[model samples]
Structures are given as structure tokens and as C-alpha cells.
Target: MNQIKKWISENIVVLFFCMLCIAAYTIAGQNPYVVASDLINRVMRNSIMVLALIIPILTGMGLNFGIVVGAMSAQAALIFVTHWRLTGVAGIAAALVMCTAVSVLCGYLLGRLFNRTRGQEMITGMIAGYFGQGIYLLIFLVLLGTVIPFWDDQLSISTGIGVKDTLNLQEGMKGALDAAYKLPLSTVCIIGFAIFTVYTGYRLWKAGDEEQKAGRRGRIVRWAGLGILLAALLVIPVTSAVIRRCSIPVITLIFILLVSLLCQFVMNTKLGQDFRSVGNDIHIAESAGINVNRIRIIATIFSTVLASWGQFAFLQNMGTFSTYTAQQNVGTFSIAALLVGGASIDRANVKQAFIGVVLFQLLFLLAPAAGTKIFNDSQVGEYFRTIISNGVIAVALVLHAMHKAQENAKAAAEAEV
Candidate 1:
């Protein structure tokens, strides 16, 4: 009982997420398969954006509210793709190349500005987003068909001097990735679970070894037991569900998993180590002869470039883009999703990102139906999710601030002692 209590305490946030999901499922009473299918799709679509946040966080830039700039860059490139009538993978590739170039420039400028105001990166990023939005508006709303040479009647406004408010990609590039080969959920789940079990066991064993080196006895057994329990908890029910013969977009799933794996791999490289050191203490890193500013710039550049590709993926999957407003909340919801997954301003990982996508999309999937059931209005659900998403971000920021305050106070007390 005490062990269960301790586990609950350690995982209170995840527990709350589970409880909310249960409440949503009960109140909404939606089709289980439908929910699962939607959850899978949304997870693949949004995970990249959320994962993009990890690098900036690792470089000590906080939540990187400036990712919106990268989203904007992608949106701009998307306009050209739509205008050129580029279709399928070709369209996505063009937007990626264009967006990467734009994001690199934006990230470099933003990084240099952030260096000028070291501790204020988040605020600086937020301001830069707003500032960049203004420029974005000028380019698309005014310059696109006017100063720039765009000639697509379908994409441009009737007045022929700007892009339209919304661009549809159904005929051009929708489902390009999702239309690839399908896979049985059971096979994928088994493979996934096997990987999870081995990885979890290895992590626990390493932790146990570290504890032993520090003179903590019996930790190995405890860690092994805990890891086994966690692995079972994740695998058993999920495997059972998979055996029901559901299907997934196998190619898209593989791509997402590859991206996740790439993120983990990057963390083992020299650049990743520099990101960690700078993240932990920029002053200390500088004293160790690291190029602190250069590392930070690289981090932002990677984050921006990743966000661009993520946005491109999102646009292709959704089949439409609201030119004026599509990217506005990219940073907001991605950050909220990351925080929902158990990431913080200072630390995040791919597993947390995927988990966060699942949990966040679960709420997104059920909130409307639940709202309609209780209030007799489906629109309530839409409003609820919007408010809740922003609310989660606000709550996370406050918690981070409070945690920092507590740490500072503890350090001061220890110094006095």
C-alpha cells in the first residue's frame, strides 16, 4: 500500500491525466475504436512540433515561444507550393527547403538577439514571434502578389494582390504521407512493447548501478522490480488492444518513430553534450571554453528547422491551411502538449513528447463530445479545448516559476547554514 502511494505521489500529474481521460470517456461515450484512430493520427501530426521544443529547452532557452517564427516560415513557403500547384511529396519537399532557409535566417537573428538579453530568452522569443508576425503579414498579405510574383488564381485573393485567407490542399498534397502502406496494430504494438521493455530494463539497471556506486544497497532489486512493473503496465493492455485487429498508417508511423529515434540519437553526440552543459549552466560552460553563444544559436537553428518541417507535415496531413492564422498557436499548443507529457522548461525527451501527444490529443478527441453531453452544445467543447490548452501553458509557467523560487530559497538557506 505504501509503495502504491509512493508511486501515485511520484506520478500525480500522469494520474490526473488518466483520471481526466476516464471522465471524458465516460461522459462522452464515444466509439473506442474511433477515439483510438483519431488519437493515433493526431499524435503523428503533432509530435514533431512538440519534439522541436526539446532542443531549445535543452539549451536553456525555456519553452521557446519563438517556435511560432518557424511555423510562420513554413506557412510562407506553403503559399508558394500551393501557388505552384506542387503535389504530394514534391510539394512537401519544396516547402521544407524553402522553410528551412527562412527558419535558418530567422533563428540566427533571434539567437543573436537572445544573446544580447541572456536571461530573457522566453520573453524575447515571445516578442520576436509577435514582431515576426507583423513582417509575415506584410509579406503574405501585401507583398505576395504585389511586390512578389505569384500567379496562382486558386491561391491568391480575387483582388490579385495577396493570398487568400485559407488554402486547401486536398487535391494537391493531402495524405501524401498517410497514404503509404498500412500495418496491423498488433504487430507494431508487439515490436514497440519489446523495445520498451528492453529500454526500460536497461535504464533501470544503469540507475541501479549508479546507486550502488553511491553506497545505496538493494536499489538494483527495487529498480528491476519497478521497471518490470512499468514495462508490463505499458505492454499488456496496449498489446491486448492491438490484438483486436486495428490498423495504422504504417509509413507515417515509421517516419514519426524514426524522428523520435533520431532525437534520442542526437542526445548522444558532442553537440548534444554541449547543449546539456550550456543548459545546466551557461557561465560554467563558458568557463570550460565552450562557445556558449554559438551553441545557443545552433540549438535555436535546429529547433526552428525542425519546427518548419513539422509544420509542413501538419499542413499536408490536415489538407488545409488557414493562411492568416494557422501557425499562430503552433508554439502554444506544442508547448502545452510537451508540458502535458511530463517535460519542463529545463528538460524534455522524445518519450515524454510522444506521451504528451497521446494525452493531449485524448483530451482534444473527447472534450467536445463531453462538453456537448453536459451542456447540450458541441461548440462548448471547442471553446473548452482552446481555453484548456492555453490554461495548461499558463499553469506550467507558473509552476516553473514557483519551482525556481523554491530552489533559490533552498540554496539561500543552505548558504546561510
Candidate 2:
């Protein structure tokens, strides 16, 4: 009874929303298939990004507003990608690489800056994102086409100097990655594998399997064997025309797998230990000979760079960018998605990232449709969604603060006792 009560308390919001959704489904006449599919896609795209927020939280770095700065770096890379008319997975790859390099460089710079303002990391990140955007816009608006040389006339505006209002990569890059796989099968399979890998890694960490973690060569061997088996399973699909459909799914799956593994690896490194220690006690970390400043710099750089890749992933799907407001409020939506993914300031995990995306996106999927059915107004649905997403994040932050204060009080009391 206590366990059940605790679960209910922790997830009351999810339960209420879910119950509301079921009620709406029963009341409204909507296709279950479309709703489910849309919800699934939303999860796939958002889960990875939300997972990005989990690490910093684990290290007690707070929600990384610096992530937005990374997104800007990606957008800058994308300006050229779309301009070149590279549509398929190739385009996505080039853009990711470009954004990554740019983000890494910028991330290092921001992280260093952050080292100076340790207590105010979150606010500092917020300002950094804003400042980064100015540089992003300047490069896109000015140096891109003329000095950069945009070969793809299709992406250029009627004026020929600026990019078009919208980018149409449907013919070029639309489902390029998705098209590389076997319709929906590879898509699900790849994501499933990625999820499984992360889960396994989590289990390893939780069990405190130092020997297993230390066996780097053994892990590589196992991966190789698994790869051979997977390749065999994919033989028939490859022979058929289904190979194209596997492209996006394969790439996306690989991307997720790499990030998850990267996270796992980082947590085991000396640098990772530094982050963990800093989270526990900054002053102690400094005393222990860990250059607390250097760690902060590294973390910031890594976070922003990854954020840049996420933005690229997002824009590639949108197939367009507004010269004026392309990234205007994407930061808010992304943060909402992360918080909705169950990430708090001090603690988060891959499980939370996944579950959060599912729940958050379910609401997103239903908001317009649900709102229209209930309120008899589509615009009302939009209004509710906008308000609720923003509101949920604020509430989560407050709740986290309250929880932390209570924990601190309990610890202090125990110490006194």
C-alpha cells in the first residue's frame, strides 16, 4: 500500500493527464492509428534530446540552458547544408559533423566562462544562448551565400542573397534517413536496440560492476559479435528494396546508441568522476586536486556541442528556417520537453528521459485534438498546450527545489541527532 501510494504521488500529473486522454479518446471520434504513430515519432525525436539533459542533472549542474547555444551552432551549420541542397542522410551527416565541430569549440569556450560563475551556471548559460544566437544570425544573414557560396539555388530566396522562407527537402532530404531503412521495421528495431543498450549500461552501473566496466576490449569483442549477428539478420532485408527505408532509422539508431554509450563511458572516466565529485562538493573537489575549473569548462563544451547536433536533427526534419525567428523559442520547447522527460536540476536518468518524452508528447499529440473536442475550439487547444507545457516546467523546478530543501533539512537534523 505504501509503495503504491508513493508511486501515485510521484506520478499524479501523469496519471491525471493519462486518465484525461483515455476519457477524451472514448468521447472523440479520432483514428487510433494516426494518434499512436504521431505519438511514437514524437518520442523518437525528443527522447534523445531529453536524455541529453539527464547527465548534467546527474552531476548537479542544473538544466543546461547552454544546450540552446549548441542548437544555435547547429543552425549555423544547417544554413550551409540546406543551401547545398544535400537532402539525404549524407546531408544530415555533414550537418552534424559541422555543427559538432563548431559546438565543441564554442562549448569549450562557454564551459571555461562558466567556471568563473560556478553558482550561477544556469543563468549564465541562458545569457550565453542569447549571445550565441546573435552570432548565428550574423553568419547566416551575411557571410553564408556570398562568401560561403550557396550552389543550391533552390534554397535561396527570390532576392538570391538570403535563404528562402521555407526549406523544402522532401525531394532532397525529407525522409532520407528513414528511407534508408525497411519502412517502419528498421525504425522500431534500431530504436529498440538503442534503448536496450542504455538500459543494460544502467544496470551495469547500478550493480557497481567495476570489472565489467574496465574490460574495454571485452566490450568491443561482444559488440563485434553482436554486429555480425545483426548483419546476418539484415541480409534478406538488404537484398530487397527495403534497404533504403533502413537509412534514417539506421542512422538515428546509431546516433542514439553512440550518445548512450558515450554517456556511459564518460561516467567512468576520471573527468566524469570529477563532475560527480563537483556535484557532491565543489570545495572538496578543488581541495582534492581536481581542477574544478577545467572540468566545468569541459562539461560546458561537451554539452553545448551535443545540443548543436540536436538542433541540427530537429531542423533537418522541419526542412526550414526563419531568418528572423528560426530558433526564437525552440529553447523553451526543448526545455519543456526535457523537464517533461522527468529531468530535475539535481538528478535525472535515461529512463526518465524516455518516459518523460512519452508522456509529454502524448499530451502534445492530444492537446489540439483533445482541446478541440472538449472545448469546441482548435485555437483553444493550442493555447492550452502552450500554457501547460510552460507551466509544467515551472512547477517541476519548484517541486525540485522543495524536495532538495527537505532533503537538506533531513540531513541537517540527522547530523544534529
Candidate 3:
């Protein structure tokens, strides 16, 4: 085959998978179309979390494995909000604030750590994630009672070392966020993410102009997007009714969108360009007068804030927090999801993260059923899903290293040649 045809043939696997999925959905159920809606919702819910990785990826710092640190901040904020009896959008707002504060601090620290350990950012980030988890656990489990004030017994452990096995947030607010009685307006925010994706694509199409131009200014887009986001934030309740309503998750999503867009806008500014440049090539950026270390610090902080927002969304959706294990493994899995979405080691877009979350989650949600169809045993499916999710991360990391190796080899060979 010619090169063009060969390229198409090489991508045949994706086409085949798409066709296979359609076929299986049609064959497996009486309501394949109904199933499609659930799939879409799952995609919408998970995509923005994936969207959070874009900045770090743009800066060539690799996946924000330190996003776990941000996730910890979010979970901590969530716990406090719940303990304080904050409900509805107010609770979510407060949680975001708390999460952002924690994320900024965590990001600042992580940036310093990364700066000290430069080339091993991924490993430094991974270790930072663990370090944050320990700190997070201490706050949630041990410190909340003795040092911090905890009024609720449910939130406080019997031994007072940590929270209980599971802290049901609704016992305080009673499904204030997830109540089906509310409107499903949050769906609009999900739609907003889609709209943002479309806008990003449009921007990509206009990249040549953008690159050559001074700056986007982005005033009209900014004001208009903010106005729409605020409207959706207000309508989250009314919109929740159209679908099975979940207010908190929707609120969390809108918050995340606003934050991510804010981050995107930041990336597009002069400072933002400098930030990207530093990530692209630190030596060049530094020579050009960019403060590479500061940019790295700022980038880490940005990643933390977004990840914290993501964790807030995740928790608000579940309306329950697993005290011990909930926040620990976030970075490993989330970074994996981004990788699965076709993001490379040094670059990721918001859309890729969204696609990865949806695709990864579709498999997560359906693998048991899909497995039952194939293996007639869902337990087997469950086990396999665990393996697949972890395997995706492991493979991505390995692929990242291999790709880096190839780049170094090619550069060296070219120099020699």
C-alpha cells in the first residue's frame, strides 16, 4: 500500500474498535441508545478532571503527577465543608476555596522540590504525591481532632486518630447536592466543557494567526465565557431536573471549568507564553529572561488548584468520602487516564484529558457488564478492570521513557552523522 493507505491501515484498529463498540451495544441490550446517554454523562463527569492536566503538559513538565497533592487539598476542603454543615453550592464554593488554598501551598512546595530535583520531575512528582498523601491523611485522620476542631463525632474517630471508615456527607446535608428533586442544570456546564472543546479546536485552527499575533486579548471571549459559566452555575439546580439531578457535582464541574479556562487564559498571555516557553526549553527561556524556576512553581501551583477542584467534583458526586484510601491513589489513576486518552509524556490538551476520562471510564463502568457478556462472571471483570487501569499507567510511563530514549538517540546520531 502507498504511505497514505498504509497510515489508514495502521489506524484500522481504532475504526474496528468503534465499529465493535457500536455492534456490541446494539447486540447486548434492548436499549442501546438509552445506554448511550449514561455513557455520555459518565464522559461529561470525568472529562474535566482529565482537562486539568493540560497546563503542565504544555510546559513540558510531563503529567502533573503532583496533581495528587492538589487532590489532597480538595479532599481536605471537602471534609471541612461537610463537617461545617455547608450545603449546596455554598458548600461547594467554600470547598473550592479551601482546596485552592491548599493546592497553592502544595504546588509551591512541589515546585521547589521539582526545582531542586530538575530532570527527575516525574519521579519527584510521584514522591510528592506520596508525601502529600501522608500530610493529607494526618490532617483528616489524626490532627483534625486534637489540633483542629471537630464538632461532629461522625467526622471524628472513636480513637480520634482520623475520620471513620466512611463519612457520609449527606448525614450533614442530606443529598443537598445529589437530590433528584433538584434540576439538572449542571449538565449545561458539561455542555460548556464541550463548547470549550469546540472553541479550543477553533483556536487551534487559528493557531498560525495566534502565534504570529501579539496576544489574543481574549476580552470578549473571557467576559462572555464567564457570563455563561455563571449562568450555568446558577441554573445547575433547574437543569438537574432534566437528567437525574446531581447539584454538587455540577457545581464542582462548573468551578473546575472556570478554573481550567482561567488557567488556559493565563497560558495565552505574555507571561503564559513565557511559561510555556520555559517548559518547552528551560535554557532558551532563561536566556530570554524568563524565570524558569518561578514558571515551574507557578505551573505546579496551577496544576494543584485544578486537581483539587477535580477531587472536589469527584467527592461531591459521590457525597461520601472514604477517609483512608479515597485521596491516596488519585494521581496514579488520573495521570493514567490522561495517558490513555492519547496524551504524550510532554504534551496534553484539555480535550485529550476529557476523551481519556470518558473512554477509560466507559470501560470502567462497562467492563463488568462487558465481561459478563463475554466471561459470564463479573468478578472476573472487576479484577481485570483493576489490572487494566493500573496497566494503562504502567504502560504509559514505560512508553514515555522509551520515547525520551528515542529522542536522545536520534539527537546523538544526528550530531555524530
lDDT (Cα atoms) of all candidates against the true structure:
0.81, 0.67, 0.68
Q: Rank order by TM-score, top first?
A: 1, 2, 3
Model 1 lDDT tens row, 151-194: 67787888888888998874757777777677766666667657
Worst 10 residues of 1 by lDDT: 211-220
Estimate the overall C-alpha local distance difference test score of candidate 1.
Answer: 0.81
Each candidate's number of clashing pairs is 0, 21, 11
Q: Model 3 over residues 238-354: C-alpha lDDT tens digits?
A: 433434433234543455567666866887798779877987888999899888888888887877777877776667666677876887667766876787666777767666676
Q: Rank the candidates by lDDT, best first.
A: 1, 3, 2
**Residue 206 miss distance in model 2 (angstroms):** 14
lDDT of 2 by residue, 277-396 (tens): 988888998899988777777777767766776666566555556645766665566667666654667666666666667777776677667778888888887786787678768866
Instruction: Please list the residue runs of candidate 2 whose C-alpha ends up more than 4 Å from where it truly belongs after superposition.
Output: 3-29, 87-89, 143-152, 183-250, 405-417
Best of the candidates, lDDT: 1
lDDT, residue 98, candidate 1: 98
Please provide TM-scores, in order, for all candidate models, with all chains considered together. 0.85, 0.78, 0.75
